[model samples]
Target: MNYEHVREVDPAVADALEGEVQRQNDTLAMIASENHVSEAVLEAQGSALTNKYAEGYPGERYYAGCEYADEVEELAIERAKELWGAEHVNVQPHSGTQANQGVYYAMLEPGDKILSLDLNHGGHLSHGHPANFTGQLYEVEQYEVDAETGYIDYDDLRDHAEAFEPDIIVSGYSAYPREVDFEAIQAAADAVDAYHLADIAHITGLVAAGVHANPVGTADFVTGSTHKTIRAGRGGIIMCDEAYADDIDPAVFPGGQGGPLMHNIAGKAVGFKEALEPQFEAYAEQTIENAKALGDQLQERGFSLVSGGTDNHLVLVDLRESHPDTTGKDAEEALEDVGVVLNANTVPGETRSPFNPSGIRAGTPALTTRGFDEGACREVADIIADVIDDYDDADVKAEAAERVQNLTDAHPLYE
Candidate 1:
């Protein structure tokens, strides 16, 4: 990871790359949507495939010298099919957002209604946030989690679906802690003759490992990021039945993007192969267990976790109830000072602004990748709780930073 070859041509860029590697090695990455990929994945992502231009699917590319590109892309698509059990798979979309765009472009016309979860309630910006293209192109209706229980109100979602008569219903989430009921969401979509697009961007690995309930068969379309939880390189994927394959392939390539990022697709193939091994199941299981331990420790320290605790890999802690004076940004900065890197997220019933919300979301996917167990994650949670308890205290921050260093040393990521 030294980038010595890059140093000769561009010392500044090489320095930044080396600095980033060192930063990851030193800090705790608790961000729910992030994970560390294997060196194999890293190498594949930095391959010469980046220079290739394979404009079409395997066996039907527009480019002449696409033999290796076709091979890598085919491997990725096949592995993804095996990982998620979909009839058809597209490994071309540039990102999870683009994956969602591919579905919308294929199945939806402009001004068609979109029913999705509200952004403040753990839903993604691609799932109909006003700033995104989906919100701009379609008439959007939102469903929310129960304010008291912190779970999706499935019945309410059904009611909203019936009322809105949306053309598509979006499920899966970004910061949510509980497992989504994709079947229930599918039922809601079916009741209104709507399409179901489950964006399992955060739980792709969990589902592939059978740690989380899969949405592939139930939803009409399934989309996800290959990076989060999956430990693949940065890319997005789409899966659907054979009937929709024609529409999806074109929608992703010529419609939403031009040439695919073949290097990232190579990384996806390598990571997906790694995930197929038995150890990946253990990793996914430990990820959920670590989240539970982290949430339990946080609660024991008097922090209020949304939904009481987590069933998945993330825990959303509302700082308003635990530390009323501290904003999520304040806690985020303090935790960063102590080497725990997570995000300040908006809770279900948000009272503060989106930029500096009232909640902090943490997860175990990256820590689990670093071979952390429940005990290790509990210790990390204690450090986090200490930071929140004494966010302004320099002595506390110093002590917490020392403890985080100890944990990072024990885990030894990318070493």
Candidate 2:
């Protein structure tokens, strides 16, 4: 795990890298999009494959000596297929955003309509945020969760899809904490004759472990990031029925990117192999249990959860109702000072700037990776409430910092 070679060549970079490792070890990583990969995955991602330019798919290449690269890529594709149960899988997209781009390229013209969840309502930037390329290139409309219930209003989505008559309907989310009903969304897309793109970027590992319902067989296209719940180093994947294989392959390759990052694909392969073992299922189950426990503890302390609770890895806490005087950023900065890390996110019907939104999003994947269970997460919830309640008090922060240290010491990262 030590970067001795890097130290000899670039001590400055090595210092920063080692500093990051120490930071992760010391702090609580509750950020919903992150997870700590295994040391085997770390070694695979840092392997010599990084230097190879594997520009094409397995058994097909634009350069010489791609035999070994092909082998690695093939294993990643096969394992992904087994994990997600898609007839066709493309492991080449550089990210989940690029994976979405591949699907759009294959399915729509520049002006075609897209219907997706609203960004402030737990959707992703790549889905159709005005600042993102997808929003700029396509005519976009959005749906939202119920204002009172904090759950996706599937009926509204279905009605909106009919009115929009979009080229595609995007499901899945970034901040919403409930399990998705992919079948319901699929029915809506079918009625509108639109393609269904399920961006399960945050729940990839949950679906693989059978804790979350899979979108592969139901959605027309499924895209996800390998590093979130899955603990694969970092990359994106796309799955589809064999019917659209040709359209997708070209769209991802010459359509969006050039050479693939073989090392990242190798990390995905190793992580997927690790996930196939029996123990991974328990890990996935515990992640949800921890989230429920964390949210329950927060509720008992008077924090307002967006969905009342969660059925998945993360929970969205609306600071407006719980601590009206304190902004999400205020809590975020104070928590960081106490060595607790998470993100301030926009909640439904948000009134503040996205830079400093109304809610904080927390998750259990990273903590669970470090061996945290329900009891540890409940303790963390109390620490979070303490900071939010008295963010300016040094005594409170010091006490909370001590608690965070105790938790981190108990369930150490990268140990």
Candidate 3:
């Protein structure tokens, strides 16, 4: 695979790369929005196409000598449309936030009202966090999850839509664990005469594999990251009904971004091809199983889970009930010390600031891709609980680190 070729000229950079691989092999990756791509995807991303700068859509580029780039981009767009069953697709935006911005530019004017989920309550920053461009440009109204159930309350969302009279209703989240009822959200938007945009970035693979509800067909516009569960290169895609294709394309191109990353487009094409394989469906299903098993095991070990449990590939662990004195920051550090990687997140209604929240978010997609099953997940949860239980004691941390090393040795990722 020539993976070691980089070491020949720059041993320092090569050592860093090797060290990263070793870290991945030694740690349990549980970040919900992260996954490792296949070698083929990696190869495409690092291919010669990166040298090109085809500034426009396929066959209509601003620059000449883009025949190969045109072919690769066309393949990516076509494969993405077919995989998601969307009427039109634009595989250009550099990331999910950028994709959301493109959608906004396509459909609404600056200062238009947007009703979206609240950030601390599982919503993505692009959905309207005060710090993001979405919030700065748009008049944003945020809806929160029901405090008791930790689930979206459609009635409350409807109330917000009615009061805000928003031009767009955004349905999607970054940390939520339950299945999003797009139909309900759409209906609410319909009642308010607002456009519905579903940002299914985290669950795109499950939707493509038919393991989760497909929002592309129902939403007026659907935006997602190609990486996450889709296993594509790090990029974003915006799909919509054919009626808005022209507007979306222009918004993504000259309106918001310049030339597309042709190499990443090629990698996205490879990812779409992989998603079309029947085995992808099995992998998607197993991801959910592993997540549910992990959630149940953690709950059994006295860790409180938001939304009771997960119906998707990720879970939000509310750390307040489990470790009374330890915050999500403490848990994150302790887990890292034990060679398990996860992110601290804010639970719905959490009082802590975003920098140090009350929850930890974890997922099973990467681990399942590395061949772990439900039993393995159970063991992982037990270890996680043990680490959290003794986060302050140095001896406990050392013992947990040894156990993590043993688990990683047994699993042996990227082999």
Candidate 4:
């Protein structure tokens, strides 16, 4: 993985790149939105196709010398269609957010009503956070999870939709730990004559692997990131019925994004191919098992998990109950000092600011990708409990770091 030519051209950038690889090799990555892509995907992303300007879909490019680019894009589209079982798939959105934007632009008008989950309650900014352009452009209203159960309140969502009469209703989440009921949300959208855009950005691979509920047939529009659970490429995808293909393709291309990143599309093709392999199914199944194990281990340590436990790849720990004095930021920094990486998150009924929220979110996809199993995740949880129990204790952090090093050594990445 040495960037020899990069060093010859730019030593500083090369050092940063090498350091990042070493960092991934050394640390545990529990961040829910992140994963380690395969070397094949990496190679494809770094290929010479990055130089091409493929401004349109596969055979309809605006430029010449695009035959190879057309081949790669076509492969990516077909593989994605196979992976997700969509009538139409657009593989060119730069990110998951842009994919959502494509759906919005395709069907929504300015100031149209949008119904989505609340961000502090496991929603995404692209769904309609005030700081995002979605909120600024649309008339947005939010639904919440059941504060007691920490699950989406579908009945309440219906009530909100009925009252709001939104143009689009969004399902799927970022921090919630349970499997979503896409049909229930679809019903809600249908009752109100609203389009449903299910953003399975975080659980794209889980859905494709058939471990989680798929929204393709249920929802009018489906969007996901290629890199998160899919481990494909660092890009976004949009899926819809053939009825909306014309609207979506133009929305993604001439409306939101310009020329596509053909190299990343090549990476997506390679990754989608890898995901089609039998081993990738095992990997996907194991990822959920690891998350369940991690959550159970955390619970036995007296930690409070949002939604009680996980049915997917991540767990959300409510710090307000178990560690009343410790903010999520406190636990986050302390754990990072010990080489266990995760993020501070807001839990349902959050009382703290979003920046220093009252919860910590952790996932097992990256660890599972590094060959970690249930036992390894339990050990990691024990170390996390140790650090959070005594974050200020330097001796505790030192011992935790030692254990982390041992675990990382046992399960190496990028080699």
Candidate 2 — what's its lDDT?
A: 0.95
> Model 4, range 107-224, lDDT digits (tens) per residue?
9999999999899999999999989999999999999999999988888899999999999999989998999999999999999999999999999999989999899989999999
Clashes of each: 0, 0, 0, 0
Backbone-clash count (model 2):
0
Q: How accurate locally is residue 392 in candidate 2, as Cα lDDT from 0 to 100?
A: 89
lDDT of 3 at 238: 95
Kindly report which residue stretches of model 2 are placed more than 4 angstroms away from their true locations once superposed: none
Which regions of candidate 3 are displaced past 4 Å?
1-5
TM-score, predicted candidate 4 vs. hidden true structure: 0.99
User: Could you give candidate 2's per-residue lDDT for residues 11-56 as a string of tens digits?
Assistant: 9999999999999999999999999999999999999999999898
Tens digits of lDDT, candidate 1, 1-415: 7698999999999999999998999999999999999999999999999899999889999889999999999899899999999999999999999999999999999999999989999999999999999889999989989999999999999999998899999999998899999999999999999999999999999999999999998999999999999999798999999999999999998999999999999999999999999999999999999999999999999999988999999999998887898888998999999999999999988999999999999999999999999999889989999888988889999999999999999889887
lDDT of 3 by residue, 59-88 (tens): 899999999999988898889988999989
Provide TM-scores for the models: 0.99, 0.99, 0.97, 0.99
Q: How close is candidate 1 to the true structure, as a TM-score?
A: 0.99
